[model samples]
Target: MLITQPSDLDPASPGPITIAQPLLDHLAAIRADVLASLASGEPVYGVNTGMGALSKVRLTTDEQKVHQRNLLLGRAVGGPPWLPDDEARAVLIGRLRTFLTGDAGVSVELIQQLVAFINSGHVPAIPAGGAGSAGEIIPLAHAFGPLAADLGPKEGIALLAGIPGATGRAALHAARARRLADRLSEIGAGAIAVIGANRGPYHPLTARGDDVLAAELTRLRNLVGPEPDPRSLQAPVSFRVAGPVIAHVRRTLTHLEAAVERAFTGVTDSPAYLDGEFVGTAGFHGIDLAAHCDHLTAALAHAAEVSTARLHRLLDPAVTGLPAQLAHEPGPQAGLVAVHKRAVATSHALRRLTLPSAIGTAETSNGQEDVQSFSWEAVGGLAEAIRLAREVAACELLAVHQALALSKRPVPPGLQELLLAVANVVPPIEADRPFGEDLTRLLDSVL
Candidate 1:
């Protein structure tokens, strides 16, 4: 990958990174300027002076040389569940973007070592949880410390300065959430067919100039087509509000996408070099990224709750006018009743993760670093939410497939393949055999 700009970094790409000589030369010049500032007997925050609580303490020449190395070794804390290979690559890509602009004043040699590590296709075992530092020092140390035996003046601080741990995972999570969002729309379309819900709410004019709602309405309209003989004049609130709820998810996703883009492209160096002088900056703080992640997680949890409501509707005899629970015989075979229970459980679990991680604050490093973004926790929460959200989708699909089968209504052409796929893994609720295994298969092979 050739990185001419921060936007050039593609975390999803498998790569050996390459930088043009001019950019490398530019970085070298910045390094020289930083070194000159250090040589003039002036204090630079992690160079000739101490860091954090010891910022005012001056260092000897020998201490200055070893400070960079010690910074990484001392900060490598915590243990596994290390980041998976893809997320590790993303962290590396985020780190590389920090280096591209030379604001951190990192050496080109250090930059090359980072490139070499990426090109080698091996990642260090950086811990995926228990990260509570002011920035991402713990994970950053685990990721980069072993690669370089020695680091120049500002290189160590540069490596530890940004919240790449959060940014990298957020980028991946936002993409994953988007896919989940689209799949939920398709699943909602299936439920509409099975429920024979009133078609009024899906009318284009109901959108009221909201593009996201309009798009969802169009999708549902096309998928369910003409519902000539609807079961009710107005469906349950859950069914009526499906379009708006899904449109809300899309909006939250849009907010996350914008935040991730800004993080990837913005400078995030603490004590960044500006106008040929070292200056402290709050660029390391990631409140925007953290809060947006919380928003998306909460939105997904709401979607799951709505999906569970719709699943319950499919089981109600009054709603569907079909056999209760879509069972062949309601007495001996419990049918999809237990499935709705599981949906309820999963939906509640997802709801618990909606608490905002960004609202919490802590003091560390002798109170020199007094507050944190809790960005890692935010992204991690979303990751779990994605898994639970999909499981909820699986539950709703099971009910939709069973209800449509018992209804004897012709399946919509758009939903034929989906119901057919569900039927492949989740055989009809013929005698209420263990549904846990069927749900497992649906999650593994289908959803």
Candidate 2:
């Protein structure tokens, strides 16, 4: 697809190979405006003057070009563990989307080069850490430094302005998390039915006016098929509140989608040319996306907690009406006891990752850059949280399948289908054996 607007950029969508003509026109117009402003002897922040704490220092026309090159080279301080190829591709796409808004004042040639970079499958070596600036200067610089020779007046700051690294990473994580959230709903419903949980908590009457909750109820109904008699008067809170918990994660994904869309479409360059004048603003701030990432982390943590609790319920004989740890024999062989312990550790680690990274700030760039949005860190934490949540969900699914097998009760058609799918990769746990590969295979098959 041709790159033109924010909606065109999806994490799962293929990268664009060509730039739209309208975007090219906008870039030309912006470049003309920038040149005219410089010719008028107006002292722009990055065009004619030094950046950050040195903004007071005036630069001659000849020195201004050199300054732009230096900006890219000087800011390339990203550390080890380069971003993955897919993530780097996302960052490049995000950066190109920002330029399409025509606020960056970059030349058409520079935009074409970026497109060519993506088309050629050349992933920039951007580090996964050390982005502490007000804007994503360190990572952006590393991603764009190779093209410094092509940078024009004021283009360096424009290139570094938008929070592409954080925004792109967040977009990728949000897409994956959203897909996993939906699959979790299906798997969770199967688990609930296997344990004979009360259906009142997921009844339509319980779904207030929230659309997400209503939709979750419908999905639960489809997966659970028909409600059996309640095993206990009231199921555990984890089982009862599963619908609400998944609803919360769905809400967070909606907010993140909006935030990421804005990051792609909005003009975030400094010294934006608006209303026939260059105005300095905080368009580069990444708090909008940072806060959304933090919320995603919290939502994933809650899901992990619920999954862990459900796994615990499946292992208890009193709760599941099965042998301890779903063991074929009570005490002769250890069944899924070790798997439950691993789920516990995974959930606890995810809970620890729920701390918001936006709150951690420090003064840098000689105190000129204060109150940073640690958005990159927040997205990184969210990625880890998603991984742990998936692992926890995998454990819950394994336990639920085993519990259903031990009960020897007739299951809903939906749950029976799920069991058959799981059985394809993971056999019934007859005796104690290494289940590490089984867990991985189950997660891959279902999620």
Candidate 3:
């Protein structure tokens, strides 16, 4: 966890430090090689010629230096609503990771400046949208625009050639989603215990050799206590399938982790230095990251749907064998009816956010950059989906806690601990009051 290189920068780490020696040595070697290549007068893309539509246009030695500065200035077209501090840090880390691969043909001085920028904690104001290229040209331009005067040789193309913006955003979302998935398991166990769900569904014999299901069964048994008498012949599908649904979410997260790992270590620049020569490549593409983000979005949407169903069951008298809406006075008080509506609305929004952004593409850059990953749009939508899902989870926890309070059956010790935490912030709903503040407190407590 020392963060000696870009790959060592953890999402949870507090801040950046000075670059270590091993990284400095690799950078020195790469810079020497790039200088050697330039001395040989070999035609290299972005170093001696124009970029994109003007690749065939060669440049004089003096013009090539000017091109470097112009590259950064021309692409600084990012808009408002800047990326937050943590995400901005992630963006720096992503670019630094790619730099460590020694494929961008940048100088040691430029690398040190980047390290200084990160360590000083001064995040550039990178706008929120406008990524239409194979690589994220606009955002990268804004991020590195302040340092444009320092760029040399092919460094300008190097800065814009990687998908760091998309990768950083995805990394932050993945970290948050992973934490939420863990909390989902605990909340699901509490809901199952409160509902008096049949132990039969969670039995080891019924797990079918799936490790995630088997693990969930053990967790539910511990929370609710073993061998509970069923309230009905069978519980609702939402109650019975909570274990499997959470298991699927975990599986999706695993796939996303693999994609993120690849992004961290892989070379994602065009005209990359590989096998001792500068080679043209499509390494800047972000389809793997974008596709996995779409998958995570779908998984979260499904979890929201399941949570809404469970909340509905808790509100209905026939399903829970409790008074309607968990009302203190069955006649006058409205109880959790409004809370149910809020949860339903959040679930609907989650579904809308799940439409895959990677499925569509529009050609830009005069058809030079025809296909795009749209990974930024995909990660942005997924981030919103995750936020809505957290709201849905808060609603379910509130309703389940209230339902458990109304039940006369003796609660297990483990469940009592969970109930104590919920009751600390969300008091038993005896009458109708503004539950918005209560919901916010509950979300903060649980998440």
Give the alpha carbon lDDT tens digit for every residue of 126-172 in model 1: 88887786777888889887765878787888888878768888888
Question: What lDDT tens digits, residue by residue, belong to model 2 across residues 228-254?
Answer: 677887888988888889989999999
After superposition, candidate 1 runs with Cα above 4 Å error: 14-17, 20-22
lDDT, candidate 2, at 229: 77
Model with the higher TM-score, candidate 1 or 3: 3
In terms of lDDT, the poorest run of 10 residues in model 3 is 9-18
How does each model score on TM-score? 0.93, 0.95, 0.94
Q: In terms of lDDT, which candidate is stronger, 1 or 3?
A: 1
Instruction: Give residue 202's error in model 3 in angstroms.
Output: 2.0
Model 3: lDDT to the true structure = 0.81
Off by over 4 Å in 2: 415-418
Q: TM-score for candidate 3, please give it.
A: 0.94
lDDT of each: 0.85, 0.83, 0.81
- What local lDDT score does residue 29 receive in model 3, on the 0 to 100 scale? 89
